[model samples]
Target: MGFTTRPELRGTFGAVSSTHWLASAVGMSILEKGHTAFDAAVAAGFVLQVVEPHLNGPGGEVPIIVTPAGADEPIVISGQGPSPAKATIAYFRKLGLDIIPGTGLLPACVPGAFGAWLTLLRDHGSAELEEVLAPAIHYAENGHPLVPRIANTIATMRELFTTHWPSSADVYLPNGEAPEAGKLFRNPQIAALYGRILEEAKTAPSREARINAALDFWYRGPVAERIEEFCATESVWDVSGRHHKGLLTADDMAAFKPEIEKPVSVAYGEYQVFKCGAWSQGPVLLQMLQLLADTEIARLDPLSPDFVHLAVESAKLAMADREAWYGDSPEVPLGTLLSSSYAAERRALIGETASMEVRPGSPDGRRPILPPLMEVGTIPQPGLGGGEPTVARDRQLPNDSQGEPSLNKEGAQRGDTCQVSAVDRWGNMVSATPSGGWLQSSPVIPGLGFSLTTRGQMFWLEEGLNSSLKPRVRPRTTLTPSTVHRGGVPYLAFGTPGGDQQDQWQLLMLLRHIHGGMNLQEAIDAPAFHTDHLPSSFWPREISFGSVTLEARFPGETVEELRRRGHVVTVGDPWSEGRLSAVAREMDRGSQIIKAGANPRGMQGYAVAR
Candidate 1:
C-alpha cells in the first residue's frame, strides 16, 4: 500500500490518487491538457516528487512495461541506473558492511523515473514537458489541501522525515507539527522549481533538452549543490563515519541516463502476459499467470467458492517461484524461466487436490490441462450463451521477432507509490506507477516536490540470493504498471505499489476481470489471499497459502480441508488490508463505461469523471 485509493473521474478518463494531493492534481491537469493516459501518468510522477518528497524524486529509478493499442511490441523502459564504478563487493567487505538496514542517502540509486518519462514522450506523448507538468506546477505554487492519508503518513513517520533532511522538516512540519487533513499545505520552494522548469522549457528548442533541463535542475544544478551542502553540515550520512559517501555528487547526478528496453511477454490462453525484465519482479507476475493458465482457473466461474480457492492456490504457487529465481538477470540467466516450455512443465504440477506443501519446483515444459469454465449468472448477449457467459475476446500481442531474451530485475520498495490511468476519446491509453520509497530511508531535497529514493533497502544483504545488495548491482523491484487490451484495443490500465504484494494484487485483479469476468470494482474489492510458498524478498523462506485465509473467512470446515492439504495457516484481522487502485474502460454498444476503484482500506480517495 503506497499512496491513497483510486479516485473516480468520469470523462472517459480517470486517475487513482497517490499519497500526495499534488500528484492527483497533476494527474487531472495532464488529462485537462489533452495528453494521453501515459503522458498524464508521467506528469503525475513528476508532480508527486514535489508533494511526496521522502519516497521518490526526479532522481529516483522506476522500471516500466507499456503496451500501446493495436501494437504487437510492448515497450519496456528501465528507469534504473548502472552501479557506480566505485562500488564493488570488495569495497563493502573492506568496511565490514554486509547489510544496510533500509535507510540512508548513500543507498540512493541513480534516479531514472524522470528518464522513463522521456522515453514515454519519445514513443507516446505529443505535448511538451511544461504542458504535461502544468498541474504539479500549479499545485506547488498555489498550494493544496493536505489530505487525510498524507497527514497520517506524515504524522506516523514525522521523526524519520525530519531526521533525514532538515529542509523536509521545515516544509512538512510547518508550525513545528504535522498538519491535519483539510489543512492548506504550501511549498513555494517546490513551486519555484517548477516555475524554473517551465521558464527554461519555453526557450529550449528540443523536447529532450527541455526535459533534461528540468531533470538537471533537480540533480546537477542548484538542487544537488544544496543537498550536498546540507548533508555535509547535518551529519545525516555518518554511519559511524564508515561507508559515508556524503551527499550524491554533481557528477553522479549528471551521469544518470534512463534505458529503453524490450519487455518480456508470454502467451497464456487467449490473453498474453507482459512484464518488465529481471530488473524487477515483473516477470514473476507473468510467470504466475502462466502457472495459473495450466490450472483449471481460466475456465472457472468468477465468484464461485471453487473459483476463489483455485485462484488463491495458483497465486501461492507463482509466489513460490518468484521468491526463488527472480533477480537481476544481468548476472544470471533469469529470462530462461519464462520460456513456454518451462511454463508448461510447471503447470503440470498443479494437483487437483489441495496441498499445504508448496515448494519451488524444477523447471519443465509441457502443454497445460484445459481448465473448465464456471457457470456464473450473466446477462445474455446477442447470439451468446444463455446464462451470464464469459466475454472471451480474441486478441494477442505478437511475440518479439528477434529471440533476444529479456534481462534485468533488481530492487524496488514501497514507500508511497501511486498509479493513474486515463483514456481519451481517441482510444489512447496511459498506465503509470509513480513511487517514493519509505520516508525513514530518504529525504526530499529542499523546495523540491519529490524525494530521493531509498530503493537500496529493497535489496538483500545476504550473499547468494537473487535480491542480494551487491556493490555495483541493481536490485530487483516490484513497482509495476500494466495495461490490458481486448479486441486489439486498449481497454484497461492498472498498477499497484505494494512492494512484493504489488504483483499478487495486480494478478488477482487481472484474472478476476479478464478471465473470471468480474467488474473492475468487484475484482478490486474481493478479499485477497497471499502466498509465502517461495522466498520472500524480506523473508528468506516462507510461503503464505490463500486456502488458510480463505477458509477463515468461510466455515471452519474449509480451513480443515486446507489444513488437510498441509498448509500452515495464520489468520489476520480484517482491517488494515492492502490497498489497490485501478481504472478500466469497457465499450458496451457505442458508449464507453469507464470505471475505477480504490482499496477500502484507506479513508481518502475520490473518482472524478464527467
Candidate 2:
C-alpha cells in the first residue's frame, strides 16, 4: 500500500471518525462509558454543532443512516426540515425574486438537527439526555480553541454582522472584532439554552420521556417561541439585496417531526450500499455505482486517466438525473431510475472523449423534465453572505467564472457541511452528514445564539418540477451519508462535507477501496477529483460544461490526458479536494474487529480507536 497520512486505526472495542478531532474524541468518550454507537453519535453530533459552528449548528439538519446490531437493514433518520407553510412560489414571485436567496430569514426552514438527535437518542440510544448534552454545553459555556476556518468565516462576515445583523455580532464578535485563530471562543447563549432544556427535561419520569420532553421544549416550548418571534418581527438583509421577514412560525415547528424510514439500497459486488431516499442526493452515489457495475473498474489503475474519466462521466450522467428527477415529492420514479436496465442503457453513453451536454435518461420510457438551465457566468460573484462555502483551485475570487468562491490563503473555504461515523462493540453503527444553519446563512436569532437553516434555497422557482418550491415540502438537500452492508451484515459507514462533491468524493473513495484494493486510509489519501458539469444545489445556481477539478497531487500526464479528451481541467492545491472519514466492522476468526480512517486535508479530521 502507498504511504498514508495516518495509519488506519484497528481495534476490537470501538471506532469513531469525524471531520473535527474534538468531536471524534467526544464520541470515543461516549463509547468508553459503555453506551451504544447511537448514543455516541448523538453526543458527537451535538459536539460537532459546538466545535464546527461554521459548518453546522443547532438549527441545521442531519440525515443519518444507522443499522442496529442484528438488524435486517439500515434505516434513515430524516432530519431534513420542510419549508414553512407560507413559503410558496407566488410569495417569492411577488417579492420580485426568481430564486431563493442563499442566505437570510426568507429561506429559513424548520430547524431539524436538534429534534433529530433527540429522536435518535430516544429510540436507539441508551444514554441519558443530560449525559449526552453535557459535553456540548460545557464546551459552549467555557470555551474551545477556534479553528482558523471559523475565524476566517467570521472575519469575512464581520462587516455584515456589525451592520445588518447585530444579533449575530453580539454572539460571534463578542469583543467587537472577529475572534482570532487558535484563540478560545465561547457562545454562552448556547450553553444557557441547552442548560435550560436539561432543567426542563429532568422533570420527566423516565429516560425516554426525558428525551421526548427535551424535544417538546425545542419544538413547542421556549425555543420555538423565540424562533417564531424573531422571524415574525425582524426583516434581515440577505443575498437578494433586500430585507425580508421569514415565513417560519411556531406552528411549523410544532408540526415538524423527524421521520425514521428505510434506506434505498443497490447491490455493488458483494456489498449492498444504502443511502437516504431521493429527498436528498444520496441516490446519486448508488446511480453512479450501477453505471460502473459492468465496466473494467477493477482492472484500471485507480489514479490513471481511464479511471478518472470513467468516474467523472458517470457522475455527470447521475447528476443530470438528479436535476431532472430528485425531490421530496411522490412523483419521483426512483424504482425505474435505480433499475439495472436503466444503468446499462446509461453506461453505453460513455465514449472516448468527454460529453459536454447535460443528459438525463428516460427512465421507463418517461421523458425527463428539467428546470430552466441558467447559462454559465450568469450569476454574479458571491458576497460574504452566500451559502455553501466552496473549495476551488485558485486563491483569487470567482475561480470558476461561474460564481464559486475560491479558497482563502488558509486553503479552506468559510463553511460547509460536516460528517461523523461511529461503530461500537455492540455492532451498532451510524453515518451522518450534518449541514446548513451556517453562521453566514442567516442572522442569529435574538437570544438563540444560532441561525435558521437556509436549505429552502435549493428549491427551484419553476413549477411542475420535482424540486419546485412548495410549502411544507423538503428541498432536495445535498447532504448525504452512506452505509454499506457486506453479505447482509453492517460493514462500513462513511461520508464527506462538500455540497455537490459529497457523493462524488465518496464514490471515488469507495471505488478505490472496493476495486483497487486500497485500504480506507489510502483511498481517502489518494488524489481527489470532481466535476462542476451539473447544476449546483446552492443559490445562484450555475453550471459549468465539461469542467473537472483535480488536486495538484494527480499525475501531470493524467491531467493533460483529461484535457486532451475535452475536459475543462482545473488543478487545485495539493490537499484541497476532500474531507472524507470512514469506519467499518468485520468478523475475523469468530472475533469482531473495527477499523477507521479520516481525511488528512484541512488538518482537522481524525479517527480514534482502542
Candidate 3:
C-alpha cells in the first residue's frame, strides 16, 4: 500500500463516512448540528438514494447495526421487510420458472428503506424528520451532478427503457439521452414526493406521530396504492425471458414495519463483533469469526499468501454454512454453530491447498440442508450485470459497479447497495447497508417516483431451506451492516456495498486492521480477494469452486505463488474490488475522539471529520 490518498483521520468531535461524498457531507452537517448519529445515518441514507440510484433506491432494504451511547448491547434494526403475502415459490413455478428472474416487477417486495430509516430516527434521533431528510429533498428536487458511472449505467439500459418501461424512460431519459457525466441532473418528481411526505408529517402532533404519519403515507397510502395498482395491471420481462405480474399488495405494505432485535455477536479477542441476525446475511461474518476465534490471526502478515489463504478458506466454510444453515428462520442452531467446539471441528476442514468443493457442516447433530440445485445458464458477475441497462460485460475485477444483470443472481448477481457509518459526539453509532430497486430492475411506479425492490428474487423456489420463500417472511437477504466494540466499548462502525462479497471484503480489511496492525486506510488500501465457491443466493445461482480473483496490485511473486497452490486465479486491476469505509470512536483522556477512513478505489466514497 504505497501512499494512500488519505490518512486515517483522527479528530476530537465526530466523523461520518459513506459510499458517496455528498452523503457524507450531509451526515456530517447533521452531526455538527448536534443531532444524533441515527439522524446523520438516516440523512445520509436518503441522500444515497438520490445520488446512487443505479445502486440503491428508496425501494431498497437496509439491515442496520446500532450501538447507542450508554447502551449495554447493540441492536439490529431490521429494515428489510418480509416477502409479500403472495410471493410464494409456487407462484413463480406457476409462471413457468424454476428460479425467480433477476429483473422486472414480479420479484419485488414491499419497499423497506423508508420504514427502517424512520424507525431509527423515531427512536434515536434528536432532530425533526424534515431536518434529517432535507438534504436529499434539496438535491433530488433542484439538481445534483450526475456521476459518470450512473450515466453509463443508464445508457446500458437506454434501449430497454425505451422499449418496455416508458415510465422509466420519462424519468431517466428526460431529454431523449442518458444524462451526461458531471452534469446537473434532477428528478423533480422524487423531490416533490419527498416534499409531500414532509408536509404531511409536519401536520402530526408529535415527532413520533409525524414519523408514523409519513410511514403510513409511503407504506399504506398513495405510494402503496400506486405500487399495487401498477403491479397488478402490468407485467415485465425477467431474466428467464418471460413476463410476470407483481405479487405484492398494499396490504403487504401496510402489514410490514421495521423490527428491533438483539444483534448476533461473538466475543473475538478484545472485541465483540456485532452484526444483524440471519434474517440478513450478517451472521455469516460472525460465524466466520467464530471459526477463526482460536487462530493466531494477529500474528500473520497481512499481505502474505498464508494469511490470504486462511481467510479465503474460512470464508468458504462459513459461507457454505450460510447456504446450508443460515436463513430467516428462528429455528437456526446459531448457539451451537458459534460455539468453540464447533470451530474446532470445522477448523479441521481447512487443508493446505484450495478446496473446490462446497462444504457445509453439522451443528448439534442437525444436517445442513442446501438448495435443491444452484441454477446455471448464466455466468454471474461481481456487480449487477444481468439487467438490460447494465448488461453483462467483463470490465475489471475491482470495478465499483454492480451491473444490472438481465440474467443473474437475485441477492448478489442482479443487485447492489449503498452503505453508511456515522458516529456523533453523544456516542451514538450506526452502520447501515441500503440496497435494491435498481432503475433497470423494474418499471418505475407511475406517480410514485420510485420502483419497488426486487428483493423477492433472493428467495428460493425450493422448500425445507432456511431461506425458502414463504408469505410474510423476509428473504435471507445479503444486505449486512456491522458494529465492533473494543475492550467492551463501542469502537467502530463500518461496512461496504458489494452483494455476497460484502463480508469477504470486510474480512480482508478487518483482519489487516485488527490482526496485522495496519491502520484503517492502510488496511483498506491493501489488495483484496474473495472466493465464489459457495452456491450464490441470487437468482440463477452459480458457483465457482476453487476460484479466486485477486487485485493485480498484489506482488507478482505472491500472485504466482497462489496460482501454484492450485487456485484458479483471475487477476484484476488494482484499486477495483471493494468500497469499504469506516468511522471509529474512542476515549482520549476523558473525552471521546473520532477517526475516519474511506475507500479510494471507487473515487466515490468519502470521509468527513471535524
Candidate 4:
C-alpha cells in the first residue's frame, strides 16, 4: 500500500476524505482570515457540505467537542435536532411503522449542523459568516476539480440517484453522467444560496441578528417551504405530525435549539477522559481505555504474543460493556456507566490469557431486561407503492434444505461519513466525526446539492432494547469523535467511520501508541483486528484480522492460541473500508510536536503539522 503522511505547515491541520487539497485550502483560508480552532472547523464543515455532501450537510446534525485555552470547562456543542414536540413513543407503534432504514425524512434531526455553526460563530468566532464561508461560496460559484473517487461513487450510485430523486440528478449529473475526475464541478444554485446568506448578513444590525438571519433563511423562509413542499408531494410526511414533522414546518424549524452540555468524563489512568454523551457512541472510547489500563499491558512486549492476546481480550470485554450499557442517557443510566466503580468492575474481568466464549451480559437497566422486539407479525404495505417497509435488522441468510446456512445473501447498503482533526499553533486540538447516515434517498433535494441522511435506519422498532428507534428517540450511532489527553494536556485527536467497527479500530490505535510506545503514524499503520460478534450496525461477526493478510505475519502458535481462546477469526484486508484520521501532538515542557496520520485505504486524505 502506498501510504503517505505529512506535517501541516500552517497553524491549523485538517483532512476530509477524497479532497485533502480542498480541505487544506479552506483551512488556510480560515487561518488567513484569523479564525479560532472552533471557527475554522465550523467553516471547514460548511465547505465540506458543498464538496462532500454524501457524508454530511448543512441540514444534518453535528456533534462537536471543543477545548479552549485557560478555561477549566471545555466548550461542548450538541448539534442535534430534537424530535418534534408532537413526536412520541406511541406514534411509531400506532402506524405499525417501526423498522429504521437509511432513507426518507425519518432520520432527520432538526438539522443541527447549521445550528452548531451558528452557535460556534456567535460565541467564539473572530470573523463574520461572510469571511468564514467565503471559500465554500467561491468553490461553489467557480468550481474545483472533480476527483476520481467522487466521480466514481457518483457513477456507481447513479441508478439509485435517478430513480429516487429526479431533482438531485438534475444538478449532480450535468451531462447525462457524473462528472469526470479533474473536471471543474460547480453548483450555481448552492452558490446563489450562499450569496443570499451573505446579503442578509450585511443588512443585519447585530451579530446575533445576522446569525439568526442566516438560520431563518434556511429554516423559515423560501428554503423551509421548499423542503416541506417536496416532502408533501412525495407523501413521505406523516400527516398526523406524530413523528418529527416532515421537512420541518416554520414552527418546527423556529423552535429548534442547539444544546451545550458538559461532556461525561472519567479517569482513564492519569488522564481524564471526556466524550459526547451516550446519544452517540463516544463513551465507548473511554471504556476501552479504562479496561486496557486495568490490565498489565505496559509490562508485555509491544507486539509479542502475550501483549496482542491481552489487548484483544481487553477490547472484547470493554466492547461487551459498551454494547450493553452505552446508549442515550436521558432514558438510561449514562452517568452510572462511566462511574469509577463501573470501570473497575468491568476492568477486573480481563485475564492475561484469553477466555473462549464472550460472556453475554444485559445492559444496566431501570427496568427488567426486556425481550427483543416482536418480529413483524405481518408485512405492512408501504405508504408509497414503490417503496418497501424500512427494516433496520440485518437480513439473515436463508437456510438450505438440509437446514444449514446459505452464503449467497448480501447485506443492505450503508452510507460513508467524514472525520477531520486539527492541532493549532498554540497546541489546541480539535477532532470531529461529522457524518450522514447512508444517502438512502438520492438527489435528496433539488438545489440542496446533497442527499438527506437515512440515519433513522439505524434504529429499531422494538420496545425495550438500546437499539430501539422509536418516535422522537435518537438511534444508537457509531460516529464517535474523540481526543486523548496525557498529563493534563491534549495529545491525540482522532476518529473513524466503519459503522460498528469504528470503536474497535480507535481502541487498538490508542493502546498501540500510548501503552505500546509506538509513534502516531506507526500505530495507525500497524495491522489491526475487528470483531463481528457483538451487535454492531452490521452482522455475522466480521472478524477482519486474518482477512487482510496473504502472508502469515503472526506465528502459527499465536494463531492456534487465538483459536483456543474462541475467536471466529478471519485475516482481513489491512486497508479494510474502515478509514481512521488522526493528529497527535507530543508536548514536553514548553515545546510541542504534532504528527498527523491518514489510512492508506483511501487516496483523498493527508496529514500536516508545522
Q: Pick the candidate with the highest TM-score.
A: 2
Per-residue C-alpha lDDT of model 3 across residues 324-437, encoded as one tens digit per residue: 887788888888877878988999998888887788889888878887544233554323234433323122233444323431122122236788999988888899988887
Off by over 4 Å in 3: 372-415
lDDT of 2: 0.87
User: How high is the CA lDDT of each candidate model?
Assistant: 0.55, 0.87, 0.81, 0.57
lDDT at position 244, candidate 3: 71
lDDT of 4 by residue, 531-607 (tens): 54444342111222211111143555656666665554444433443467776666557666556776655565555
Q: What is the lDDT of candidate 3?
A: 0.81
Could you tell me the TM-score of candidate 1?
0.78
Stronger candidate by TM-score (1 vs 3): 3
Point to the candidate with the largest lDDT.
Answer: 2
What's model 4's overall lDDT?
0.57
Runs of candidate 2 with Cα error greater than 4 angstroms are: 380-412
Instruction: Between candidates 3 and 4, name the one with more favorable lDDT.
Output: 3
Better of 1 and 4 by TM-score: 4
